[model samples]
Structures are given as C-alpha cells and as structure tokens.
Target chain A: MSGSLQTLSDFLQCLIVGLRLGSVYALVALGYTMVYGIIRLINFAHGDFIMVGGYTLFFTIPAMLAVNDKLPIWLAVIVAIAVCALVGVTVELVAYRPVRKKGTNMTALITAIAMSLFLENLAQAIPAIGPNYKIMRRMFSNKAVLNFLNISLDWTTLLTILIGASVMIGLQLFVKKTKLGRAMRAVSEDKQASVLVGINVNRTIIITFAIGSGLAAVAALMYFAQYSTIMTTSGTMLGLKAFVAAVLGGIGIIPGAMLGGLVIGLVESFTTGYISSSLADAFVFLILIIVLIIKPAGILGKNVGEKV
Target chain B: MMNKNTKLKGYLVNTVALAVLLMAFLILNANFKTPFYSVVFIPSLWQISYLIILAASLNLVLGFLGQLSLGHCGFMAIGAYTAALLSLYFERAGIFTDKKAPVFIVSILVSLLAGGLLAAIVGIIVGIPALRLKGDYLAIITLGFGMIICNVINNLPFAGMEGLSKGSAAASLYKTGLGFGNTLKTKYAWVAIVITILCLAAMFMFIRSRFGRAIESIRDDEIAASASGINVSLYKVGTFVYSAFFAGIAGGLFACCNSSLSTASFAFTNGSILNSTFIVVMVVVGGMGSLTGSMLSAVLMFLLNYVIKNVIKASGMPLFVQNLFKYPMLVYAIVLIIVIMFKPKGILGTREFSLVNTIEYIKGKLGKKAVKEGGSK
Candidate 1:
C-alpha cells in the first residue's frame, strides 16, 4: 500500500468515492440520531429497513420493466421508501410502543435487538429472499459524467451524492420550519412539557420512525448502486457502520451525524486506498474512540458535562 | 436479611443438590448413545453449563451494575484463544505429565486461570472510559471494543510460537478438533459442569458481599450512592472486570466443549450475534440481576431451541412450522421479542429461587391444610 498519492487526480478520485459512500452513511446516521435523540432507543432494526428497501427494489424493478421496456426508477424509489416507512412505523407500533410503556430501557434495548433479528431472519426464511446473495439488476449505467485530467466522477456516485444532499436539506428545512418539526424539537427537549402543551408525543415519534425508515430506504438504493449484490447480512454491516457514524457525530445532533458519517467513510476509503485493507475497520474504531475521549459530545454536538 | 452462617449453609445445601442432579443428568448421557442423547440432550447440557457461566457473568455487569454491554463475547474470545493456546503449548511440550488425562487436568486449570486473568486486564482497559459514558453511550463504546477484539482475534499473529500453526484466527489453537479426543468421554462435560457450579457459586457469594451490595446501590441510585461514599467508577469498573473474567472462563469451557477453536465460534452479529445476543437473551429471560434465572433460562432456551430444531429435522410437521424452524435464529428472535413483550420482568424478576424456600412453603401449606380440615370438623 502506498502512503503517498501519485497525483492530485488520484486524491480527487478518492475524495469522490469517499463522498459517495459517506452520503449513504450520513443519511442512515441521520435516522439513527433522530430516533435515538427523541426516544433514547437504539433502533437496531433501522439497518434492516435498508435491507427491506433492497428487497423492494428487487421486486419492483422487474415488475415495472415488465409493464414497459424501461424501468420507472423514480417510481420504484418512491415505492421502496413508502414500503420501508410503513414497515418501520409498524415495527414501532407493534414491538417498541408496548415495551416503552411498561419496561425498562434494557427491555426496550432487548426488544430492539430482537426486532433486528426478526427482520433479518424473516428475510432468510422467505424462500425468494433466503440467505443467498441476490445480484441486483443494474438499472443505471456507470459512466463518467465529469472528467478533469485523470480525475473522473461516475454517474452513480454523482446521483448518490445528489439524492443524499437533497434529502438532508429537505429534512433540515422540515425540522426547522414545519409545525411537526417544532413539535419534534419540543418533545425531545422535554416529553412531559410537550405533552402538557398538547403535543401528541406518540404521533411525533411515529412520524420520526417513518422519516428514519424513509432515509434508510434511500440509503439502500445508494448501497445497491455501489455494490450490485445484496445479502441478508448486509444490513448488519451497514447498520454497525452507520451506528458508528451516529455515535461519532454526537448521538442526537443531525449535523454531527452527517459529519461523523463522512469522516467514517473517508477514513474507511483512505485506509483501504492507502493503508492495509484489513486495518480499515480498526482504524475507524480507533479514530472514534480517540475523538470521543477528547470530545465525548461528538463533533457539532454541544457538550454537557456529567456532574455526578 | 440472613446471617453469614445461614448463607453459607444455603450455599452448601445448594451445591449438594446441584451435584446430585448434574451427576444423574450426565449418567443419562453416558449410558445412552442414541441420537437424541448425542444430538439434542448431550449437546444441550454441554452448552447449558457454559452458557450459564456466560449469562451469569453478563448479569454481573448488566443487571448488578445497571449498564448494558454489547461486546461481552470479546472477553470470551480472549479467554478461549488464550486458554486453548496455553494448554496446547503444555500438551506440545510434554511438560505436565506423560499421561493424557493428567496433562489435561493440570493444563486446563492453569490455562483457564491465565485466560481469565488476561481477560480481566483487558476488561479494566475497556471498562475505564466506557464506564464513564453511561447508558447508551457506554453500550456503543463497549460494542466498539468488542468489534476491535474481533478484529484483533481475526488478525492476531501467532505464527512465531513453536508447534503452533502460522496465521490468524484459529491458527494457534491446540488442534483442529477434540482435545484428548474422546480418550475421556464426557470429560469436557465434567469440566463444564464443574466450572458452571463454581462460577455461579462465586457470583452468589460476590453478590452478597459488601462490595456487591455497594454495586447494587450504585445501580439503583448513582448519585446517592456516591454521596454515601461509594466509589462509583471503581465498583462499576470492578463489576465489569469481574464479569469479563468469568466470561473468559466460560470461553475456556466453551473451547473444551468444542472439537476445535475458530474465529467463527466467538463471532459478533455475523453469526446473527450468535453467541453474544443469545447470551443476552438468556440473561433477559432469566430476569435481570437474578443468577438463578440466568442459569435456568440458559438451560431452558437451549433445550427449547434444540428440541424444536431436532423435531423439525426428525419428524413430519406442517411445512409452515418447519419453514419457521428452518432458520433456528428466527425462532430465537421471536422468542426474545415475545418474552420481552409479555414478561418484561423476566421469569425471575431480580428474585432468587431456592429449594429451602420452596420446601418451607410446601410444609407450611400442608400444615395449613391440616389445620383448616380440623377447624371444619
């Protein structure tokens, strides 16, 4: 492995690749941050939502292509997102709500893990989507949309970044300007206060789940774009990484998650690109631990010292 | 509530009862070479004993300390590799004794101790900063450490040691398969049961100790405990270390139970959090903070899962049920979810079960029944 880059083009290429992958992680991390911030539950099943999205694409692409010679890629994307949102909300209502009301945080945590297990293993149990790697049919071509010197950015990477940016911006504005967004902010700030003020806490939480799952859906599409194959275990790996992103960027802050994801993706890409490939995961964790020890609140997150 | 004298007596009586029950259980396995014994019952017992150790150890951290740790299997992996490697060295060098059984006896103890001690040291390193984080942050940190342990195990270089295979992961193991290899049938089962008994007893004793009481206090009210002069971090980290040590011992017993040592054995979620998550399931099902519950649930869940799997394979069943059982892990998920949803306090709910209490309750009931009959007459 070369410690030094041969050219600026190579550096730009690495940067582009990192951004493309980082965007997907950022989107997922945002979902993680939102639900965790509001409810204080680590939704382990959040990653399975991505897997659900992948399966949706698996079903929809051919169906749409059958109707016409061309695939309605945008329509498929929308459907996948909707399906994932519905599944996410349903899981919350069925599994989490009951536990939240009556059980301890540990019980809730266990429930989350079980839900994750349920989703992945359920996929494996289904004959069509059993524990085998299913190759996704390529709907888009990988061609260089922009080239400068030796630096070239492909269409898939460009699309992933654009879609990620648009979703994030839209989410940011919605949270800042919308009535529901203020209610979400107020609820996270103080649930008791929010309820006293006539805000429907449960509804806000359900909406958050829907939005988080929706982000996972978009991330799934990007994940498929990057790698043409999907497997049952893919969610676990992606979930773990996005979780690292969530923890790295401050646990509750949106910008922190975004920053954390990009940093993780860059660390991973650069480590694989310049250092030993086997060491990439170790390096990411090492960086996370170091940053956390130095700034436990995470980047872009406000620090609150533990007095007791 | 009870004096030390009574507690010691209780511990002793419990040990005797356990010894009798476990021995009879083993006798059944030794006598029967049937598929049910070999495939379902025997393996379930072997797994139950060590899993009891794992669940009890995790309870020390999660239940008593009130902290969630997602990476406990990392400690188990550390123990498994260390103990396996050490015993292998002893076996290869011909140091302990010429006889195979004697060599096994001597090396296993030393190796288990070494494995546990090393795991404790690593636990301290992982516990310090992680303990400070608290709640969910602590969980993620522990999870990070666990992943790092996995990465280290999968990539650790053990090639330079003489008589050991070169490479990462399972390379440095004693051998690819059974140690002492059926020379002593059910030998590892004996090792597992003995260790489980010893570990569970130790946990029982520790939980009653003054430090253990302090640890429980911290769990209930950290600030209040700290105000009362409890060393919160020390106790928290101590409990964490204690848990890690036993988890390592469980790993050693785990290595003994298996034919070979491999990275996959201590895998994280890639195996569906195979060893890690299920161990947590046992703790939860047993009821948090209850050692007895941990042991019972480990035995019960393993039996249920194994039985259902074997039945699916051996008997005719509806395709739907068989399909559900096709992935055993799916059943585990469903089991965990349902258990939490319905019995959130778990089967025991921080309460310990004892034969003495049960006998007394029965005696009182019979006496009451007799009195009621006389009064009616």
Candidate 2:
C-alpha cells in the first residue's frame, strides 16, 4: 500500500513538472501560432524574443529590486514585456516588412532564418553576453503550501501554474472578445478582404507580432523562474521546441497552441523522468513526425482544400 | 544560330575542362603538403569537389522538386558515419591488413556504396511524409530530422562503436580501412575527382532525360503537372531519394578527405558551411533547377569563402569583429538573405553554363562580331 502511494505521488510530481514546463512553452507557442496565422511565416526568431525579454529582466529586475524589495518582480515583468514588444515591432519593420512587401516566399523564409542567426550571433558578439551562461537567481520561494493525497505543492510550483493559467485565460478572453482581436482574426483569415473591410492589415499584423512577442516575455519570466539559466543559444532550441508545439496544435489555431504545448511538455517530462534524459529530444521529434504523418494538418487544424 | 553539333561540342569542352582542373589538383597534391601557397586557400580545390556534389544534389530537391528542405546535412551525416563505421569494421576484420591497392580499393567501394545506399533508404522514409506536406511544414520537419540525427549520434553508446569518440560528441576516423594516412591524403583527391565526375555525369544525364523533364514540370506547377499525367508524388520522392543518394556519396567523400569527423561538421550547431542552410544558399545562388549553375556556384562560393577568410585574417580588424569572422556562417547568412531578397532566381536563373556561350561572351567582350547562340543573362 505504501509503495503504491509513493508511486502515485511520484507520478503527480512528474505531472507538476510537466505543467511547469508546459506553461512556458504554451506562452511562446501562442506567439508563434499568432504570428504564423497573420503572416504565414515560421518566424524562426520568435524564440529569441524570450532571450531579449530575459536580458531585459536581468537588467531591470536588479535595478527595480534596489528601489523596492517586494514590488520588483512585477515591475520588471512589465518592463520586459514592453521591451520585447518594441523589439518585435522593430524586427518586423526592419527585416520582415520589406520582405513581405516584396512578397517572395523563399525570401521570407531566408530572411527569418537570417534574422534568427543575426540575433544569436550578435548576442554572442557582445562582450557582456558572449556565449556564456548568465544565471537568473531564484525568483520565488520554495515553500510547500499544500499536501493533498500525499502530494506536496510548493509555492513556486503553485504560482507557476497560476501565472500560466491566468495569462492564458486572459489572452483567450482578449482574442475572443476585443475589437482589435477581431481585426487580427480578420487579417489572418483574409488579408485582402480585411483591407477592403477597412482593417489596417499591416497595423494589425504588427500588433499581433507585438502581442506575440510580449507573451514571449511572459514565457521568459516563467523560464527564468524555473530553469534559471539564460544563454545566447538557449533561445534557438526553445524557439524550435515552441515552433513544434505550435505546429502540433495546428499552426494558425490559438487554443491549439496551448493544448500542443501541454502535450509536448508532458511528452518531454515523461520521457525525461521514465526514459533516459539524453533521449528525450529524439523522442519528442519522433512523436512529432508520427503525429504529422497521421494528421498532416495537426490535431486542431482544419483540412482546407486547395483552390485550383 | 548554333546547331546541336555546337551544343554537343560545348558539352565536350566543359567535360574536358573539368578533367583538366582535376589533373591540376592531383599534381598540386602529389608534390606539396597543405598550405601550398601559404595564403590560406589550400582546400579550395578539394572542398569544391564535394561541395559541387552537395550543391547539385540539393538543387535536384529544392530547385527541381520545389521542396525547401533545410535538413539536407542530416542525410550527409548518415552517409559519413555509416561509411566510417563500415571502414572501421573492415579494418578490424583485417581485409585491409597489407594496405594493398586492390583490397583497399574494394573496401572503399563497399563502404562508400553502403553509405550512399543507407542514406537513400533513410531519405525515402523521411521524404514520404515530408514531401506530402507543403511549404514551411516540410522545412521545419527536415530541421527536426537533422537535430534528431545529431542528438542520436551524440547519444550513441560507446560499447559497440569502438574508438568511442574524440570530443564528447565527435566520432573518430583515425585508423580507417581505406588506406594509410599519407597515401590516403595524396590519393584522396583522385578518389574525390573520379566520384565527383561520375556523380555529376549521372545527375546531368538524369536531368536531361524524360524523367527530369517531368520533375521540372512538377516544380513549375503542381496542379498542371498532375493534370498532364505526371505521377507527382512518385517523381517527387524519386528525385528526393536520388538527391539524397548523391548527398550520401558526397558525405562518404567528406569522410575520406577529412582527418577528423564530428557531428558539428554535419549540423547547424556550429556556424560552419557544412550545414543544410549553406548548401541551400549555394543552390539558390547557383540557380535552382540548373545543374551547371549548381556546379559554378559551388566552386565560386568555395573560392568566395576562401577569399573572405583570407581578407579577414589579413585585415587588422577589431578583436571582437575578428572573433566574429571565426564563424563563417554569419557571412553566409547575410549572403543568403541578400540573394533571396534581391535576386530570387539567383545568378544563373535556371540556365546552364555553356562553353560556347562563354566563347561568345569573351568574343563580345573583345569587341569582335560575336555569333549569337542563345539568350544572354
């Protein structure tokens, strides 16, 4: 009886770990799906926005902590969000916008890759952040607040769940209810029709990038909160994983990104916990290839016929 | 207007020129060690042979089949590792004990053939699902495939695979069964040149056949090609597999030439030109769907890389900027971006380089009345 109870607890602990990772992926995957919906771009650099947001937090949090001991985290989170949004807008304007205007499919993909490489290598070139690991000191206290059925829920874990849930719920509500959100949907569904309907396609697209990048900032906070290490190359791997989640949930669908993120997170965590940690990535990709083979459009994506 | 006679002559001229270039490299290799001129451009000739094969094979998939695959290096790595392991097994078995010419040649032939065959099989499996998807999905899946190969290799246990690894991630090819160290170094160029010409000839002949025409039609428009009774899926997979086969051969050649073999040499983890992105850039710069363009761009880009590296070294640039130059991927990334943005069709733009056309170009350049053969770019 004790052995069974211990196994159950271990499983629940694994669940909590999966959920913690799922939330960060969910946030980044949301941004990916949104931008992809609007622009039909993979935006290989979307993951780097998390790093940008992370650097912002690293610089701003310490400064804000000097001002007020307790209120710094929230302030720093807001600043990071704003900075990421601004950076997203700037990247869109400088790199993606010109390519989009030209309307070459190959160029768009190449430019996205170039932008991604540029950010990664540029970050490495900087003297302060030259390819070394920068530590994000622990943010939340690890006090176990609840013990239900012999499963302990710590303060950090609970807050991580709350943060992911609240932010996801808030985003869902905003995208579903607001006028601007409707404009975003309109642009994504039909760019030319949206233009005829008096929707500013470029502005809506830019705003979508901003919102997506801002969400990436939130994901960064969640990442630093849990993993606690940031490096120049970390963003590319994170971005690739998030991109997989976005595709697995159906590329353009909003709720699908969240569901996909959780599935990937669970898959990853279970693989790491049950199988060898080294083989987790291979398993994730294998699963993705299998899913794609079975359902090419993804779980939530609709099968749209091509017009001849 | 020049007739088919002139065109055939032009092709003959091109083939002979390629032979001459190979002979020159062989002569240079036999006499001197690396850094023949001490100008940091020694591998420019040897590197071109494999890169030409890589670029041309990639063109078959990306240029002809109209698939944007970024995981091409994955197939190459499969070939390299497979060839290396096979050679290691042969060495252990003592078939290559005396290092005799005939036995060593047989071993290399078996290993290279096995490597290429293995890569092709994997390509067919990867291509079936990947080719079905359109656009970005295919690209991302290939990207995932490359990473998975890298990770799996990194995790491959040392229990059965002797020589374990040099670095934490790189597998060793120190005592390969192909030949001795000095001899392999000298004759490797000859092996590369022969294999390269054979692969290029096979690819060129295939590209000019009925099958090649059908594949090109698929790239032009999927719906129209299907309407015209082209088995789109069949042709797509066939071309992709064929491309991967040659890519595997290229990888086998790479394993033969290089002293060290690492996962970094075959993936985007390091900012080297060995990855899929670099190959894609070369194909695009050469002109997708143009075999001659692929060849020309491969040689030109290798030279360009040599030039860039030498220029960076010779210049008294800033410390950080010089450090940045250590990664050649940055410049390739920029080059890809600029090429894609400005000249989407690339330098050749679906045209083959003809020797006759070059003669005409030089004649026109010297202010002579040049006989026009075809259209000029």
Candidate 3:
C-alpha cells in the first residue's frame, strides 16, 4: 500500500510540474491565438519574435548585472519586457505591414518567415551578441526552492507560472475592458467594417502584434529564469509547441489558449517522466492530430459552416 | 533578314552551352589540383544540384498543387539514412559474392524504393488532414508533423547512444556490416554524387512533361482543375510522394558523403538543415512555376553561401560574427525578404525560354528597325 501511494504521489508531483510548464505554453499560445483570431493567418515567426524578446532580456540582464550585481529582479524584468515590446512593434511595421497593405496573405506568411529567419541569423552573426554571452552560465545555475503539499518545487518554476498567469489575466482585462481591446475585436471580425467605423485598422494590428509579442517576451524571460540557456535556435521548437497549444485550445479564442496550454504541459511532463523522453514530442503531435480530427476548429473554436 | 541566321545561332548557342558544361566538369575533375576546387567548389555544385531537385519537387506540390509542407527535410533524412544503411551493408557483405548477384545496384534501388514508399505513406496521412483544412491551418499541422518526425528520428535508439545520437549510430551501423572505418573508402563519394545528379536529371525531365502541366493547373486553380476532371487528391498525394522520394534520396546521399548521420543534421534548430528551406526561397526568387528558375536559384544560393563562408574566413572577422557566417540560413532569409519586396513574382515569373518566344522577340526588334528605315525614307 505504501509503495502504491508513493507511486501515486510521484505521479501527482509530475502533474504539478506539467501545469507550471503548461502555463508558459499557454502564455505563448495566447499570442498565437490573438493574432490568428484577427487575421486568420498563423504568424509563423511569432515564436522567433519571442526569441527576440528572450534575447533582449539576455543582453539587458547582463548589463544590469554589470552595473550592480544586486539590482532588483523587478527592474531587470521590466527592462526585458520593454525591449521585447519594441522588437515586436518593429517586426510588425517592417515585415508585416507591407504585405498586409498589398492584400496578399501568402506574401505575409513568407515575409514573416523571412523576418524570423533574419533575426535568428542576425543574432548568430552579431559579434558581441553571439554564443559567448556567458551570462546564461552565471544567472541560470542558481535555483530557488519552494514546497507545497509535501512536494518540493524550484523557485524559478513557481515564479514562471506566477508571471505567466498574471499576464494572461492582465491581457484578459485589457481585451474585455479597454477601448483598444474593443477596437481590436472589431478589426478581427471585419477589417473594412471596423475601418468604416473610424477605427485605425493598421494601428490596431500594430497594437495586437505588440501585445502578443510582449507576452511572448514575458514567456521568454520566464523561460530563461527557469533554465538560463539561450541559443540562436532555441525558439524554433518552443515556438512550434506554443503554436500547437494555441491550436489545441481553439486558436483565436483567449481562455481556450490557456486551457490547451495547460493540457499540453501536463501531457508533456507526465510522458517525459513516466514514459520515454523520446516519445514526448511524438505523443504531443499524436494528441494534436486527434484533436484536429475531432474538432477541426478546436475545443473553444466556433465551427463556422463552409460558405461554399 | 536575320531570322534564319538567328535561329541557326540559337541552336549553335544551345550546343555550345552543353559542350562547355561538360568541359568544365571534366577539367575540374581531371586537371584542377586546387584543394579549394575539391573541398568547396565540387561540394557546392553537388549541394546546388540537391537543392534544385528538392525545390523543384516541392514546387510541384506547393506551387502547382497548392499544398504547404514543413516536413520536407524529414523525407530527405529518411532517404539519406536508408541509403547510408544500404551502402554500408553491401560494402560489408563484399562487392563480389559467391551467392546471389552484386548488391551495390540492388542496394541503391532498394533505398530509393524505400524512400519513395515511406514518403508516400506519410504523405497520404498528411493529405487526409490537409484535404480538410486550407491555408494557415494546413501549414501549422504540417509544421507540427515535421517537428514530430525530426524529434522521433533524433531520439531513436540507434548506434548505442542516448538522446538522439546520429553520428554514433551511423558509425556503429556502418561498422556492424563493413568491419569498421569502411566509410572512409574514397570511391563511394564519387558514386553517390553521380547517382544524385542522374536522379536530379530524371526529375527535371519529369517536371517538363505533360503530366507536369496537369499538376501546375491544380496549383493555379484546384477547383477549375477538378472541374476539368483532374483528381485533386490524387495529384496532391502524387506530388507529395514524388517530392519526398527525392528528399529521401538526398538524405541517403548525405549520409554516404558525410560517412555518418546525426539528429543534428535532420532537425530545424541546426542552421544547415534550415538552409534546406532555402531551396524554396530560391524557387520563388528564380521564378515560381519555372523549373529553370528553380535550377538557377539553387546554384545562386549555393554560390552565395560559398562566398559568405569564404569571405568571412579570409577577412579576419571577429569570432562571433565569423561563427554566424558559417550559418547560411540567415543569408537565405535576407535574400528571400529582399527578393520578395523588389520582385515579388521572382525572376522568371512563370515565363520560359523556347524557340517561339525567342523568334517573336527578334521579329519585334526587326519590326521596330523597319519602321525607323521607313521614316527615314
């Protein structure tokens, strides 16, 4: 009986870890969903945009550390967030706007991919910013500890989940209450109609990208906070997984993104720990396939009849 | 007045072009003693050829069939790994055996078969879902499938190493059959290159055929193509399988040339593999729906990569930037963006060179000249 109970405990413990991890996926998924909701285009580079955010923090955190080793964590986090938002806005203006103006969705897809690829390579090519940024080695090696319900957890894990959840709630409030949020919803429903009502469609698109990318930056910071390693290619798989979460939750729906992410996280954690780590990705993909088949639109997605 | 002469000249031009290409290949192989020629130039040519095959095949599906796929490298990796395993197995069994026929040819044929069949199966599975979804949804699902395949291969317990060991597996797999270090046998690289080139040529011929026209029509407008009695699903699956088959062959050739395999080579996180997508960019930049354009872009991309790497190595760039230069995907991304902005339709833009277009152009030029002479008169 004791052995069985111990096994159950371990399983539950793994489940909690998965939820924490899922929160991060959920946060990133929100970005994918929001942009996808309005545009019906998957921003292929959104994950890389998140990487830009992470890289921003990667550079800024070190500079802060150099100035004063004891600089407050909140200040460092704020700098990272602000820098990521700037990058998000720039990516929207430079890469997305031109294609959007031309009314070519395919061109936009290709452009976003090019933009993402450009940033990744640019990061790899820049002398000061490339691989020797030893800051990851210094900051990520240390772990903070926390205990709950007879289970011990790392402080970074707890902090990442907290930050991720708070941002989601914050986004929820922004979308539900603010005028900009209402404008964004209108634009998503019908771009021409929204424009006719005096809404700045381009500005709203820009704001949506900024907010989405800002959330991605938060995810990036939390990601680094948990495990401090960052590489040029780090965002590729992470971004893909987050997009999966967005799709799983009913892409373009807010709450659905959160639910989908949490499910993915738990599934990943349990599979990796209990089953073989090799099967982790395969399992997630299988789940995605199944979900898409059952609900082509997603759990929270509205299944609009094909107009044909 | 010059029409007949220009026609003769065009024929002469084509013949001379062929001769020059043959001469260049012979000189490089037989006369050139430069290490640069062997290590970089030859490989770059081979790489471009491989990219041309992949991009052209992909265009049949994406450009013509209007299906998006992020799983192209998976097919290439499958082909490569299968070929590598076959080649190593035959070399170990000995070229001349008292029992059964020589396995070398058989092994390569089997590898191609395996690559084609395996890719077909996967393509069929992908097509089922793809048939339902349009646009970005299809792209996302396909991307997901690609990641899954890459991760699975990386994690496979081959070569006795853990956590996606590619190099070690190829070594062990090779050693198990060939008595070890046989991959270092030099003749195989030449053989692999020959086979790869031949396969690419065959693929190019197919793309120029009438069937290729049917495929292109599907891409231009699937609904119209279907109304014309074309089986949309069949063509989609056919193109997907065909593309994957070549990608697999490329993968097998990669394994043979490199003498090893690793998940590192197959996954997108690795920049080299990401550059695999450059073939698509090349196709677009050279000209969508033009096979020659695909060929041109492949060669151009390969040359750009070669120049960037060589320039960085020689220029004494700082270590970080130098390391960055080693990854060509960045250059691909930048080139793609610039090309799309200035020339969105690509260089060829669905146009092709032929006797008819060439004659019409000449006739137009002469007509203008005659008008000038008449005015002067």
Candidate 3 C-alpha lDDT tens digits along B13-36: 655765676667665566665667
How well does chain A score by TM in each candidate? 0.96, 0.96, 0.92
TM-score each candidate.
0.94, 0.91, 0.85
Candidate 3: stretches off by over 4 Å? A59-71, A133-150, B1-28, B31-34, B96-110, B158-214, B273-276, B315-332, B353-377
The local distance difference test score of each candidate is 0.82, 0.81, 0.69
lDDT (Cα, tens digit) per residue for candidate 1, span B221-327: 99999999999989999999999999989887777666566666665575433467667777888999999998888878877777667768677888877776888
lDDT per residue for candidate 1 within A1-308, as digits (tens), equals: 23354466677778888898899999999999999989989998999999999999888888887888655464688889999999999999999999999998888988988898889989888889988899997756688898776678888899889988898889999999999999998888899999999999999999999999999999999989779899887887788889899999998888888889999999888888888787788788878887777777777767776676
Please state the error at residue A52 of candidate 2 in Å.
1.4
Residue A46, candidate 2: Cα error in Å is: 1.0
| Best-performing candidate as measured by TM-score | 1
- If both were scored by DockQ, which would come out higher, candidate 2 or candidate 3? 2
True contacts kept of each: 0.60, 0.42, 0.46
Per-residue lDDT, model 1, residue B349, is 95
Tens-place lDDT per residue, model 2, A1-308, is 48988888879978988898888888899999999999999888898899998888888888888888778374688999999999899989988998888736776776787787777777776777777889986777767898787778887778877898999999889988999999999999999999999999889989999999999999888888777888877777788888889998899999999988988888888899889897888888888787887888888988889899
Tell me the deviation in Å of residue B116 in model 3: 3.6
